[model samples]
Target chain A: MTTKTPEQINEDLLRPLEGTSPRYLAALTFFVLVVLAGAAAFLHQVYAGLGVTGLNRPVFWGFYITDFVFWIGLSHAGTLISAILRLSNATWRRPVTRCAEVITVFALSIGAMFPVVHLGRPWLAFWLFPYPSERGIWPNIRSPLLWDFFAINTYLLGSVTFLVLPILPDMALVRDRTTGWKKKLYHVLSLGWTGTPRQWSRLEMAMRIMAVAVIPVAVSVHSIVSWDFAMAPVPGWHSTIFAPYFVCGAIFSGIAALIIAMALLRKFLHLEDYLLRIHFENLGKLLLVMSLLWFYFVFAERLTTWYGNGSSEMAVFWPTQSGSYAPLFWAMVVCNFVIPFPILAIKKLRTIAGTVVASIGVVIGMWLERFLIIVPSLSHKYLPYSYGSYRPSFTEIIITVATFAGLAMLYMLFSKIIPIISVWELKAGEVTETATAPALARPEQVRAD
Target chain B: MASVNSIYGLFADPDAADRGVNALRHAGVAQDQIVVMSSEPHEGHAFSLLDHKTIMPWLAALGGVVGGACGFLLARYTQVAYPEPLITGGMPLVAPFPSAIVTYELTMMGAVITTVVTLLITARLLKWKQPLYDSEISYGKILVGVLGPSGAARTDLENRLRSAGAEKIKTTGQL
Candidate 1:
């Protein structure tokens, strides 16, 4: 690793925030336009009716629900990983934590929108809130969707707090270095931080508490999302394993998304010096573990379902295994397992480019996994007379595409506004590393790689 | 409130800052009177431990207990308030299992929020008036100082800091 002074680290990390190039503006404009199109499509859907989308009686939940699950799962990338890394005291997490946390905040905001968008009268979505009203009715606490409303909101708040607390000092650094209106903007954002020992110690204490607190919240958020399906009597959806299965798949896809986001930031922001190859390799190894875990869950779930062979369950399973959904199912399997397994398992193939390729496959495969879980079970009910098929409408497709563009735009804007890396944490790491380097060089600690 | 007549010293090395703290203590400055600040945490260091004890965890737990009680009451009161005929068929009012989910979420929310609030209060965040500060602290320097000392004490403190290898000594605000 190349050693950089504190000044160099600050300059390199803050460079992206200093200036906006034409290419960046163009990319921003393009993303904005795509997102606008998505909003327009949603508006049209609202102006029309549920008929505008490819949704029906038996197939009530379609692309919107699938997108909801997929984005929520993707949100597992940041806070969970960062919290776990911090708890485990992984030193390399310094550069990667902020970017990962940013993803959690942004992806979650986007994911939370789908439930609103799916509503026939989204304007009345506030009814989901459990506040007292003139009618004296409350949101059903027994319902998983209500649980979702509370869980997702709590997670979002916790995530934003987790992301913001550490930013105060970095913002103070910007406040000190810059002048004019930029100084004033950072002044407020920095919350008048003077870096007193009490302040630093308190901040550290708060972070410790949040790190311990957020893990269970994250796990429960996905578990609650899973319970949305599991609580129902639907054949494939009603299973005890759904919670763990969803949580594992969530972390799996989350790591993949984090890898993709890091690659982009490393490329665009010129962070090659900071976001080193070792970070990617370490994350790639994690992805490999999650891949194996994901496969195990899928295999176990399928084996049980197949062995049980209840007529209603097989009715839903056969279509996914050999019928109309077979192609998509096989594609999901290949993307989630076959492609990533080899690329990640072999050390030689686990380079930056190789992990990115595997991550892309995992992202797609995870989306398909969500879609297959929702659609096939809903479409193939136990009663043959009530059986139906579903496909996404142009509106659903446009909105789904828009969500990705929207997330990218938020991420780009966030990178420009805030230093994407934690400057103080890096410096702190250097101090500890310098202190510990000689001890680590002792013969017993040296590894023969 | 920021103290007036503050004397500050900037040191490029934490060890020098540590010496400054020791010198201040030796020169009759109380441990509470010496203020130290740095860009990063120096855990287990003397300056980090000075005046650093906190009650944030206990307070956050109280917040969680309060929030959980509110969640339980909200769920139960609202359920019982439902008109007798409007009750969902056969299902009992105020099911413990479902209500526990809301309780858990709100408990976490309350704890997280209270923790942040406690940090702000204890750290004195957003206080526009700050004690003797140096922007160079952000550039990998440690700051050690005595806030609002007497005129005679200020000179002695400055001398101690200079002797302790302070790169720059600064006095700010009214004496």
Candidate 2:
């Protein structure tokens, strides 16, 4: 049997579709329009300040902050899956790793911006950074808000590095295959990769090390984000279980985002053979697990608060269970826990379509969960005298829409530059004995089983 | 100068590159000279014969220490310099718990940043220079580059590589 060289394999893998299709152009146009609308809304928010939001004395943290946490949570899915799977040597992870890593980068970028947007004055946001200025006073180190600045920045840097490192060889492939502008782009990005054994060894070692190191940081980043609420002295806000609760919620939302992304890429890029039903099935199982964990945490936190019968806590709990926010609360429960647990439990319901529905539900549910966490506690403060209702203004709604649009636009732009799938890893896995061994068996022998 | 003769290189399926590396060593190639390269970083068991060392751990640890120190200094110095500090619930000037949060965040930040920077530096990235690379390597090929002396010996080495499933063998400028 003749073995193919690396160059031959790359040509076979990438030479299929070299030019832009009509569908791609249409998608790009739509993405550009959404982004412009978002930019306009963002500019309005800048002009109006925090007055444009639904925030007040009590309910200061609203949709922008919640969405910030939500996006950060979504970012975790990519890094967690890529890093953990890479370390474990899970061959199935190859087709999805690049997309997963890219999700982390884009989500982090979008998520990190929310804290800045949430600030009353967007211009003074640099105060969070430790820069000596004319003013003698520094930002409070004791505040969890400051902790978020450091945690998020670190997570973002780590994720970008993780995403870029593995794509070097693939970029080299693109460099060789294209000409003119695309060729120049890939050539600059490829960084002189010769696939020399020494370079490969160092690259592999670095990635392995990063895969192991990044997991805890990803967990910590979100946990610190959770602390922004938990550290507050407010009745419903201060809870011990908030860290794990937020982490599970984050993972649940993250997996949903991953499913959505995977589905889109599979459709657009024609990656049916690589990203198969088995991949979706595994992801469905993960979503189910996160759903149950979220339910358990939510239940446990509520049960303790209800049993304690603290008047202050009861005020917050009543709104969530049977008061103004009750509908959103119940909807969150059904979407996050009830719908997912039953539907995802069955193997047949774990199909791509079923998983997509469950994923969408979980995304909506997770959003409500964040709202429930932020709003009720603010609406039912300890003093009760200061507590007031929050009605999100048009500016807040438009800005929120813009953030979502911006996220989609970033992802759309990324797909154009990098192959959504890690071409090298996918091809590498394809050429392996383990990858090829299944084909070597006789059909009769395999059918006998 | 005594000229070296034959050089043999072994190539394997991307999945079994590590195993092939082991087998090649068992077949008598020196650990120092044999090189195994692949698209993904499989576990090191595949390259046990070769020295596998990395500077990331050291860099990460150093970053953690520096970050921790900076965090402590930031908290401690701020408290010392501010004559009239805002007291929350009559708490101590230097609360250990809050300070711990600062330390933990900075430590993690340092470690992660160092790991990322070290990876880029060690990988020799962003140089933007082009090199001779077969694009098929991205399509799941494991390449083992080996060097040996001229003529008949090189031919024998080529035969070994061919038998071991090495494809498209070509010599580099005299090494």
Which candidate wins on DockQ?
A: 1
For model 2, which pairs clash? A6-B136, A6-B137, A7-B136, A10-B136, A427-B140, A428-B140
lDDT of 1 by residue, B1-175 (tens): 3446788899887767777877777776655567888888766566666657999999989888888888788777777776763456456788787889999998998899899999999999988657567778878788998876778787788999999889999887766
TM-score of chain A of 2: 0.92
Off by over 4 Å in 2: A1-17, A431-449, B1-51, B78-89, B121-175
After superposing candidate 1 on the true structure, give the runs of residues whose Cα lies further than 4 Å from its correct spot.
A433-449, B1-3
Residue A307 lDDT (model 2): 100
DockQ, every prediction: 0.44, 0.30
Q: Distance from true position, residue A217, model 1, in Å?
A: 0.4
A112-152 in candidate 1: lDDT tens per residue?
99999999899999999988887888888888998999899
Number of clashes recorded per candidate: 0, 6
Candidate 2, residues B23-106: lDDT per residue as tens digits? 344444545555555554433334422344677788888988898888888876665555577566666767787777777767
Candidate 2 lDDT tens digits, A259-294: 888998777766676678888888899899998888
